[model samples]
Target: MSKQGHKTRANLPAGGFLAIGRDVTSTSDTSRSKPQVHKRELPQLSSGVLKKPRLDFSGKIPSSTPSTSSVKRAEVDDSRWRSFCAEIQIEPKQLLASLESAKEKQKPQKAARLICAAVREIIDHRKEIGSWVEEPIMCSALMLFVKMNTSFLLPHEELIEVLCSLLSTNFPTSSPGSAMAPLLLYKLLMRATDWNWRLVESFIDDSLHERQWTDRPSVDGLIVNIITAFGTRIPHESMYTACDLTYPERYRTVAEINRFTKVTDKEQKIDAFVMQMRDICERKGESAPRNLLRTMCTCAGNGNVRLLAARKMDSWLLNGKLQRYAMELLLWIASNIGQGELTEEDSETLSSLLKLRALKSKQINILFNIALKEILNNDKGMISAVAKLLLSNEFSANRFPYNMTMIHSLFSFDNRSASKVIAREIAQMLAAKEEYLRISRTFFREFVRSLLRMDFDFALFTSHLFNAATEDFSVLTIPTFFFKSLIDFCVMLPFLAITPTIREASQQRRSANGNLTQTHIDALQKFYADLRNFFEICTCFFRKHCELCTDNRLFVYSYYRVLYLAPAEYYTGIDQWPVETDVMQYMRVISDVPISEQLLCTVLEAGSDASVPIDAADTVDVIENLTKRASLSSTLTGSSMVPISTSTVLETIFRITEYKPPPTFNVQDENLPPLAVKTLYWKAWLISLIWTSLNTDTLVKEVYYNYPNLKLIMQIVLTW
Candidate 1:
């Protein structure tokens, strides 16, 4: 090294740098004196240095070392090797030998490259491998290649192609294997790219073929993942908005619909319909059921398909001329199959189908109406067949009638009066049948309420229903159904005033999204009309039954206790308040009856009996109990009438006759016939009524003398 080079390199270390043919400074204490250069040659470093090269857009990593025969470990953890070795879950050598033998048996590939080429060919061709089906084989192959070569970045085009293939035309995303396919590909895409979600949005549209994104779960899920890949806790509303933004054309406004009417007037032959049914059986998917329903309905009026029951079968099938072809097909099937044709298994299947549709449907479907008609017509021992096909084990007869209140949507159709008539007739039949009555008592009140909603000709139809409803209340030994039947008549009276509340509820559901079609609006209005009329008829039936109060004290007490309540805890808003116009009918009947001496004695006995004293009325408790019952009623019938205040009965009686109530009774009494207190109240209540009716402020005492009384008086006088 030269002196100048030495000076430049001298600062590299405290010891002076060595120059060629120059003296070097001693490294240790030998340099204690002023350091003098020692003669030395320049030393070379052991490790070689090279400059790094710049990377281009190709993004390929440069090789670090020269190629060798020995296998080299790449930038991966020990677990990856463990994973690759444990793929067969066996010793590495054994797995290799097994794979080698399998490979030889399948194809005599000379090298691993040939097998790789064959796999590439399969991916390109989209063929199913020997035992592995198309989905599993392709999905696994892609997963294996990416997982093993974790650093390898796949081309965006190939990734898009793979994603697109899994979601080809008519593929069912909800099916087990199919739903998982896109998820797997999505995972692969995640591993394979640093691509933006925007890229996926652009490519997914290009990739999707036949089905719209909203139509299938897989597509929707895939699209959601694309939009929210890097996001967390996205709301459902935002997801919907994302869908609307991503695919504007598919989710057009209802006003943009070009069709004048929604009805699809397709005509298919019977053979075509059968073939469609066969396809439904062979294929696997959610779409299959919907498609099967549509195809069958499309074949309506084909050979052997007749509309025997509802004359406007076409209109019902068309269902507001669109959007309900499925229901019509189910009805058509039941009607066409007739009695004795369905096997036990077939019956079970049909019943299950009806149940599934019923659970999913919001309105009364055609299947229900058809089943009801089968029950009504009772042709060819069809009741048994209809029973087997339409009724599920989940519900006894009572629940069916309970469900029918809203399902009476068929009331909006042309057969409206007949449908109501059929329902009343069904209830009568069920009531008559011991088996049905025992099991179906749950629905006793519901059937009565539904019957009351009709365009009733009381003399012709309702008279019989009311007779059945009020049947033999004289007998304390009656089924629970009959008991509920009486309660239904009383409670339903309040509903006559609350039609506007129901109308508001119907309107909220109708116009919630501002998507109400004219057809839907009309149907809803008609349905609301049917319900309004249904509850109003209770006024007439109740007025007819006013005689019961005078005849049966037990019923009279139950009626007054259930029907009236305190004003403070009244449950309804003004809209919910039923009109009190018909109140005078039942109220006046309850208002002014004379108190008999015999009744007063009964009241004194009821009050004096320590073990049977009635509970004092608590407004809070009364309102709470009424609220619970009202909630239960709403749950059962989909709508509930506002409950009357419990205090009303006492208040009305007090205002009428200025009668004071008896002292508060014991609270813990649990005596039999549970109406002990109400009975006492009724005894006093009727006195108020009588006082009002007589228009008298007071009653004078009276005594009658008989011969026995005179003789007893003379004997007492003689003794004195």
Candidate 2:
């Protein structure tokens, strides 16, 4: 038969198998010197058909310790030889099969051969292929073909061009063949772990310019298989290739992912993959066990692909990319979603990543925000996650950072109860664990120091929102340090306090107060309620122990004295004694009440005592300091003001009322202002005025009458 005729006849339809040609001379020499490969050990595929060759690696090994190395090398060489032989046979059989297959299944020979040649060239020179500068379209097309073959017969690096080419192609839904081509292309691209990541990026860029996937058939099975193979192999496929295969946005990259289906269902697929990877990754460390998962995660992030791509996040976490990539993905994705929808799998994965000793404080903070957001959003499964993280030996509350937006979202978002619950959890944690409290106290102190300078705009601030005359203090309010924080926050907003009171003044002053919205009233009420709840908690605790501590009369007296200065309501059912006073007297009689322990000792030690005294002069000094440090303009009439105390007196009063520790005189600092020191001394001067005003007016009325009840509180503490 003519060569041409034979070639044509060979191109028939039977799914022909190929057998490679071995160079007889090289094979004989190598066979004698090298060890043998046991082909029978390989796993069988589809119908017990062994598509592989009996690579002969058992010939010999020069007695250099006949170690596994020699055996491995021999085996590798033999396998290559066998693969080459298989390719040779297939050259004839594959062509014939392609030509004769049902015409519907047949693709053009030129296209197929071009792709095949490209893959062969890559397999032959993987190292050289990485350096190839010429962008070959044929080679690119081959990448699309070889990406999913699972045989590992081709070099992954050369598939870059293929990915780039495919990415550039417009959506081809015109024919079934064309549609199937992309799916096949994605499968192949998924395998090119060694390809240049930049090439994958180029594909994303090009995909941005092209059309989107619409009614696109999901190659879910193909993706599943690829993930399965790589889960075990952890192949070094390009991240962009993984992203393109998983998330194809028809428009601008990552942001366009929203056009795809809701990401909720993808959790199941990711969870399964993660479980598989966990099982496999723990088994044996391979050459590049983490490479496949890391690359895939990176691709998802870069491509702006959401959902399925996000499912691989655990893979990144397990791979120890928590610091570099995993944390960022976790935070960004949580923010994008409402945070309430995070899957348990995601929480597990994140928790595992954080447990790694390699993670840094900054990384922890990022994770904290994610967890905090999840809690804020009321993710059902996240409570346990937060608890676990908080208890971790690596937990550092101080490391967590918060932005205004995050704070706003925390208060404004739907899961208000969840926020309160988390806050309580944190409080319980602090109370139970000394080490945790010490660390957390430092963190909260720093937070307080930083907060005075922050902007909590009432207009946009979530704290301004209310439900049935109540503010959403669940996020804004808490029982421990957070309660103090909320008070401080409200105190910083002098106008919120001043405006309501001013409006209640005579008509002249009332006219000056702008029309206060119901939001403002609700905010004030919420703020008060939050404080009231905090006081109740303190009272409740004291009531439980006061009976035991009464023998220590000083302790009870000191505790009552501090309480008297705090803004408390007189219980209508009882004598006009303050709740603080009432509780103190009851605890004063308890015989077991550690009488040796004085209230002064407790107050000094508590450091967290909210009733620390401050005076007018001290307040002014702080105002001056705040003026110097405040980033926002001092103007109160417009949008620039960031609610800080008005004058030194108001500042001291606010500090006293809001639980801020009174600034003490630095006797040694000669440079310190005399007036500031004098203010601390005069803390008691306004007490009488404050005490007298309380009986006749409500909190709203006392401040409304411009009686300077706030000023009285600060002045009295200084004088006392």
> Judged by lDDT, which candidate is best?
1
Model 2: residues >4 Å from true position, as ranges?
Answer: 1-221, 228-247, 250-294, 298-524, 531-720
RMSD list, candidates in order: 26.0, 22.1
Instruction: Give the TM-scores of the predictions, in the order they appear.
Output: 0.25, 0.31
**lDDT score of residue 376 within candidate 2:** 36
Q: Ten residues in a row with the worst lDDT in model 2?
A: 588-597
Give one clash count per candidate, in the order shown: 25, 48
Could you tell me which 10 consecutive residues in candidate 1 have the lowest summed lDDT? 67-76
Q: Give the per-residue lDDT of model 2 (tens digit) for 160-277.
A: 3443333333222342222343454445544443323323233223222222221243543322222222221111223223222233232112111111133344445344434433
Please report the TM-score between candidate 2 and the true structure: 0.31
